[model samples]
Target: MTNTQLIFKKRPIGVPDANTWSIEKNPIPEPKEGEVLIQQHYVSLDPAMRGWMNEGKSYIEPIKIDDVMRAGSIGKVIKANNHPKYKVGDCLTGWGGVQQYVATTAENWYKVDDTLAPMPMYLGTLGMPGMTAYFGILEVGKIKSGDTVLISGAAGAVGSVVGQIAKLKGCTVVGIAGGKDKCDYMINELGFDDAIDYKSENVMLALRTKCPKGIDVFFDNVGGDILDAALVHLRMHARVVICGAISQYNATTRVKGPSNYLSLLVNRATMQGMVVLDYAKDYGNAAAEMGKWLAEGKLKSKEDVYEGIENFQSTYNRLFTGEKNGKLVLKVL
Candidate 1:
């Protein structure tokens, strides 16, 4: 059998294009001692993948040229080489990269029951994006009941979860998304109190109108102007969770900083960046609680899945184009 892989080729100055990656088919190899070969089913397509393509000192090392593109994946163990924690037929999820088959040790990969949720859902709400929202809002944002929570990119994966969790905690939630459809999804489907259609509305004026009391917590995913607008509406002692800056991910120039940052000093608010890996130890407990909420219908999980490994480049474009709703997943099997 052949293992198809997406290889990172040239780094781009702005948005990645067809030249950024190349696909190759190589012979599937056997697993060495203490390793297992996984037949990957789905790979996660996230905004963070954009950052991973750049050469810089960030949360994690950048992907090297000629290497298989890095991504979170869910798959079944088809062959095991004396691995203690995992066996053949076990479903596992981890950084399996962009490949049809992966041979690796059972270090970071975690066994998951596909019965609890679909494999794609695990890559969405039950996985990294879910974990990000859980920690970024609760731990970093320090949200409390009665607080007004504002989220940018509020219709996307992490932001959508942030809005729902804030609502469940008794906070009034406002979401900022690009189009009318996404805005409506947040208000009608996700139970957000209000949503700003950034594509058509003046975000600053809209924030003033929707958040009349000012915002107590801001969970930011799309940074840039929307972040500056949210900063201007901070109430006293407000907390800003900087989970991501999707707006500037593909920019050619330096990332735009919030010009209304002085609002932080004036309102005595705090802005902090959050990395989900920091809360790794508590993932099991958080996932259990979230799973329970999912079972009870208090939380919702959405995944926009596309098929075929060869379609990766086109599918990945949806992340920046805002073409897909909710968490984006790619089916490689």
Candidate 2:
């Protein structure tokens, strides 16, 4: 049978619009020795996908021109050839490009069970977003009890979890998002103590009112001016966790530099950047911990699922538009 995929037809000079992608259909390749054929269920749509599209120096190589665009996906094995311990029906998560079917070795894929949680969660909390929030908060942010934590893009997958994780650790949480609906969801649904509508309010003033004692940990997702605002109100020894820069992803010009970095010196604070893959070797340990939290009701995972691979480009655009909430995924099945 033929399988469809999206390819990086060209290296976009700036933020990718609909014109940057091309679709193609090809026969599903037979698995070689020690490989398995997987039918993709859901594919993760992350803001980081924007970075991978550009030709530049990064922690990982940029997606090559005309290659199937790289992405993380959850799939179920439909054929297992020369591989032990995996059955034809086993669901797994891996770096399965934007395709309907994937044939790869099981070396890096993790087995997933729907009985434990929903299939999409495998791409959210139990997957990269969860790990990003987990390590970025506990390890990089170094959060403590009663600490006032502020998160930009607080309604998003990673930011949402970051706020909840900080809350679980006994801190007061404030979320900053784009609109009133997102703000309401952060404060009402996610239990964040307050939320600032960055689109409608002066951020510095909002920070002053909401985080009076100053932000103890700033879990930053949307960088740029929001970062500058958070920096000015940071507490002494505050940790700014650079999880992502969703705001600057689509800029036609060079990203604006954070102007308030000197505040780190005045407050004796530190800022740290993290890529979730840096901790891939220890993902099992972190997932296990997050799983326990999920079971205990201390942490919640939300997914923004879009159906069909045909809509990949438009669905991807949602990340930059601030229209998507939670961990965005495209349901391919």
Best by TM-score, which number? 1
lDDT per residue, candidate 2, 1-333, as tens digits? 789998888777676766688888999989988889999988999999989988879989999999899999988999989787687999899899899998888788899887899988989999999899989999899999999999998898888999988888999999999999999988878788999999999999989999999999999998999999999999999999998898888788989889999999999999999999888988999888889999998787888889887899889888888888778999987
Model 1: per-residue lDDT, tens digit, 115-196? 9899998898999999999999999988889999999988988999999999999999999999999998998888999999
Question: TM-score, each model?
Answer: 0.99, 0.97
Quantify how close model 1 is to the true structure by its C-alpha RMSD in Å: 0.7
Candidate 2 collision pairs: none
lDDT of all predictions: 0.94, 0.90
Could you tell me the TM-score of candidate 1?
0.99
lDDT of 2 at 45: 92
lDDT of residue 85 for candidate 1: 86
